[model samples]
Target: MPESRKAAAAMSKTGQTEPSAPATETSAAMGGSQASPKKVSQTGAAVEKIRSRIIDLTIPPGSRIDEPLLLKEFQLGRTPAREAINQLAAEGFVKILPNRGGTFVRKLDLAEIGEIVVAHQLVENNLAQLCRLDDETLADDLERIQTVYRVEVDNRRYLNITELNEQFHMRMNQSIGNSFFHDFAQSTHRHVRRLLVHLYTLESALPEQQDEQFELNVRQHDRIIEAVRDKDREALTEVLPEHAGATQDRLVRLLQSNTVAPFPVKLRPLVLPGN
Candidate 1:
């Protein structure tokens, strides 16, 4: 079977449903006149399948996405495939180069990494202040994710660790009860996740270290949980940014050492002020 087909099947079995675009908008974007509601729904499903692959790096960064291949893989018509690609482009996940017909996943931006760190700090600090979090509210959820996270760390399942780590933070953010804040935080988490996976994949090729970083990550989770338990807003303001900043630093060091390069793509790098 083709890779996309295999992926679709696997996702079907797993019942994974990370959110994606709305079918109505997606169909309209790709010439909706001929699009029935059923076709539009299929277009949405196709978009999610491709989006999930990008999120997990299954398609890997720097890979070109052939529309014909996607159409064939998902058994989607031209309108649906084109629509999915267009949606991905708008979302910053893929780029369509001028004079180049192929669509490629957007490369990692070195400068944006720093900016994302700063943005995360600002947003999370505000969230920490606005929300009233306490142990009683977050304890059960945090404990459940932490249990799985610890096991993943010990087993050296870095990808699983990344997912659970995000879940742990997601649970913390859920305390805010504001959908907009929660969604923003989730998007930031996805960017951070790509960086983590990049480092872990690079590390896998080298001599095995003591896994100190993973251990520290777990400890950081503990600290965040404790801060929530104590209703220590000051502690949260300090630790959450620190956690993201530390990851930023690590990624920079890795890039500097040439241990790993950003995913190769055609788009110009996003350079923020003072970057």
Candidate 2:
């Protein structure tokens, strides 16, 4: 099977679109019982913390989120705990099931990941062709983003690392000088960051491995920004696909080894487990 096909199968098997576990194995793995709470006093603070934890992968993908556990962990009450989940659901960070069943974190698999990779290619390539920004501004901004990512990664401030990375890419998109393209890039920022976030984090596999990958990424950013600076549309046609392909490669391997899981079908799934 092709790498994409293999990735698709893995994602479909693990995708958690709804709060319910679609796969028998995953559902079984999440097995147990926890008591529900009655009410709580404050929800706003509880929700913010819950949102942060889920986004930071503190809760982790596929880890069953029991409200009572959250209640106790955060020292909050039932109402607050429930509200936290509700907000997460709205952001597609966590999916809430109907009738008080279960909540599954939205896990994007390799295939859904592949699609986003392709989107990156489309946007970045065209952006490169149309880049009309001043070299000084682009260089300065890219450097700032790099500085932040390096500092955050070195300090183990993983969340900040992703935000910095996103800032760099968004700056790249805006370099295109097209309002429409800029809007598209802005809309996709959340999804792109969600995928890239894991890829950047997984490099913690080894000290050498992580540091080496970080250096290479910084170099890559330098190259892409340099391409924009030089108006190298030809170079970008070659570069952007390789960039996205690297993301695909990273996503496939990590999703397989770490069990990162696939996205659950929001509407009708184009693919399913074992197809």
Candidate 3:
């Protein structure tokens, strides 16, 4: 009921977060902490805060999480904070260390990244094959989304463009009316977005290069829209792979170079061939 708690709850729903509150008595329990039923909403907010940081690479990959510091930062009680960390651990972004105190963000593994990309491409390819985006109402919906994307593109709002791109993909999957595939696609996209954020953070990937890629991505979306309009499966397949392949290669190249952002823990890139 407190103002801070209310704000936290709102942030949880939007997956946006603020700086963690300074540590208090609430910071005591971390690993084995237990939150009460009443604190569930606050716990969720804490989780969102953590997740947002992870996605933005603010909580860099392979970084050791400081429970007390996080507790202080989020101004959350022990139970809620620990629960949030545990949830992240369950989501595979954080690893719970029984021997070591607190949790750690998982290191980026090139092999795992490749698997995620390939799986995403297959799922999307299948969705494109089955989706009837040519339906008048559905086409209108996609057109509207694409309109917003174009606005972002013209304004050079690169980050907003990324979000719009994800929205476009999510909408495409949702239009299929398959709840299972929709949920799977959502998870895959989340990982893909995080990878993109990580890639953007690297020194080797200059801002101009990222801008060029964004332009290319927008053009590809234009092609995909045309493909959907014409109901051309082959065109859809081609454009979709091209879109994903560029990111895949950029990710691999970032892994191959020695330009990783600093973190408390050292994460060696899983050296896979074809880099």
Candidate 4:
């Protein structure tokens, strides 16, 4: 984007995000933990574990999140649990209701998916196109990132694969030297990571199918990385939409399937309320 255009776009989305809520006190504050290796709750480890659980879909979208149960299960104190839940809410994983308690991660319906694609395309692609990557060393870093994602694909587990995928894209955004889009893209992508993982989690897949899919994803990353390395705007532009389209289709189907469950809080019929 031209200098003026980038500024305008940034200004327009300035008010889109809000700060997350504060967390309650952790239980460990009362008594220190004794469990060494397996035990968590050292220092925000609870938070990290909860975050990981969400990414891994151990706790699927719409799954009920009872605080006390979580506390007992994770062996965390009130403060840490509160903080983790608050952070999860902030990250768009769980919805904290006034009286009903916290719910599990939320799904990206058609509308949210549309919003993501539009946001990614506008901010990410534009910044990428405008990026000046004359530095070959940066290309090396990208190649390393691509390598990591390849491993992630091979693993086919929800947690690490999706996390690495997000990191890969975030690194690409960061490389552009545009802090505004870089940060926004990272945060925006965070909210959608759970479903993205659900979309591609390896479930009863044949070796051949998994290998081909992983190969395609790796090649896609390579193409994008190469474009960035060469500062080829056309290649960057051509690859992103194509990549997102396949991703969108995959995600939509994944959400529609049973591989990654959507934890629908208080499941009910399809009746429109108050109809």
Candidate 5:
């Protein structure tokens, strides 16, 4: 089966809903009644912290997850710590090995990254094509998200920028009202979040370049809004690839730069579109 179909089937069995935030499993874990509210809150906090570290590359890819260190660092009980790891594993940020091989942070190699980019483009383009332009509120909702995304960009909050970007595209996908596509898009966004983090991190040292790239993103988003409002499928098709391609271009350039440190996982040559 295709990976997206497999993910859809898994989500069906798991009953995962569209996530407003990057760490949807945290919310799911918090909503469970097996733990006290305080413990649940702690678990949620731990999950967010750990997940953020992983995304930001602080935890590094493929490193063994230290449960005891997490408990001590987060001041979490054993149960809460375990719960947090379980949630992260489910969310694809962590890999839980069988037979006590120990859990590790998931690694992204060049091949996996290529597949993710392809899947991302497929799902996002499909969503844009199928979206109901006459939904009346679709443009308005996207405008609201873009507003917040602009703020995060201006504030240089890379993490918030990534989260809002996901929310922006997810809102578009949601407007199509297809649960299967929504779930697949949500999964792709989840995987893309970490890559965006790396992209933003690479640009962190170059304020001028970063600002220029972010401004371009804002304008692309505006064009997307305009396309939606005007019911212009041609404009949507033209702009969506450009917007996605910008990130791909930046990542390829950054990876090829000598100043950047090596990734924990071995990165083979990246073959993006037009490369």
Candidate 6:
């Protein structure tokens, strides 16, 4: 059997079934107009498990991705294992190095967090301004997403919280009716979500404070929804920065509290020429 087929068989034995391939690929494989679910492919399964570990910091930032171990753990063959790594690299979750440096989880940069926040805020604000509130359904969609977000926050499901939060923002961005802005907002929102994964994980240690902060986020989402519903550009412009800054502020507090000693990634101070 082919390597991919062998990998698929191995994965099926382990119960980690692969997701269906895209419709185009399925149709082409079947050699007919009708498309059916493809057999479990180990590649997608490996990618998802590895990506989740990286995001949840289970793999830890900057840690080498062990291919042999992954193959054994996920019951993936060589081809599928490498394919999963390449897919992760494409998603910016893993870094591939030349000259046999080996692939590593992408490190979270302290300095880049601030820049990401700025970019996210800029994109979100612009998208909000451009959004057409003529569609009442847009506000309804946002409210629906916000409801789920609040539940995730209250439940302390960090991963779910970040994912739902991203959905909430992206739903708003979708109203802009401009693909360019929507895409830009998507990329920025993803960066923020990844960064928030770390922030939320660290905050998890402090139950009282974590609950308070999460409630604040819930309230902010509510405010954003109200702004969108009322078509209040000014309110959105003001609240959006406050919402973005909340994450930055929490990160600062986490660092200052000395609770995150040794930090997950390296930290370096920026130096200017004169200084």
Best by lDDT: 5
CA lDDT, candidate 5, residue 54: 84
| Backbone clash pairs in model 3 (N, Cα, C under 3 Å; residues 3+ apart or in different chains), count | 8
Off by over 4 Å in 2: 1-52, 63-91, 99-103, 108-112, 134-136, 175-184, 251-275
Model 1 misplaced stretches (Cα beyond 4 Å): 1-45, 134-136, 206-210, 253-275
What TM-score, computed on C-alpha atoms, does each candidate reach?
Answer: 0.71, 0.57, 0.69, 0.67, 0.76, 0.74
Query: How would you order the candidates by lDDT, starting with the best?
Result: 5, 6, 1, 3, 2, 4
Give the residue spans of candidate 5 off by over 4 A.
Answer: 1-42, 98-100, 261-275
Cα lDDT computed for each candidate against the true fold:
0.65, 0.58, 0.65, 0.58, 0.74, 0.68
Worst 10 residues of 4 by lDDT: 16-25
Give the per-residue Cα lDDT of candidate 3 at 129: 72
- Residue pairs with clashing backbones, model 5: none
32 Cα displacement, candidate 2 (Å): 43
Residue pair clashes in candidate 6: none
1-275: candidate 6 lDDT, tens digit per residue? 24444543454355332322222233354464232233134676577677767766778888898678777888777777887888788767778886657988877776667667677757755665676767688777677666555555655666666666776776666665555565567667666777888888887788788778888888888888898889898888778767877876777778876778655664333232344
lDDT of 3 by residue, 1-275 (tens): 24534543454455433332211111332222465646866887687768767877788888888678677889888767777788888767789887887688877665566666776666666766777665655555556566666655565543445555676777677667666666567667767767776666572356676566667777888887888888787888778767767776665555556565433433333232344
Local error of candidate 5 at 110, Å?
Answer: 2.2
Report the lDDT tens digits of candidate 2 across residue range 157-178: 5555555666677676655545
Residue-by-residue lDDT tens digits, candidate 1, 41-96: 88778876786677667887778997788877889888878888887786667888
The alpha-carbon RMSD values of the candidates against the true structure, listed in the order shown, are 8.1, 14.7, 10.1, 13.1, 9.7, 9.8
Q: What TM-score number comes out for model 5?
A: 0.76
The Cα error of candidate 1 at residue 265, in Å, is 18
- Cα displacement (angstroms), candidate 1, residue 92, comes to 1.8
Give the distance in Å from residue 59's predicted Cα in candidate 4 to where it truly belongs: 0.3
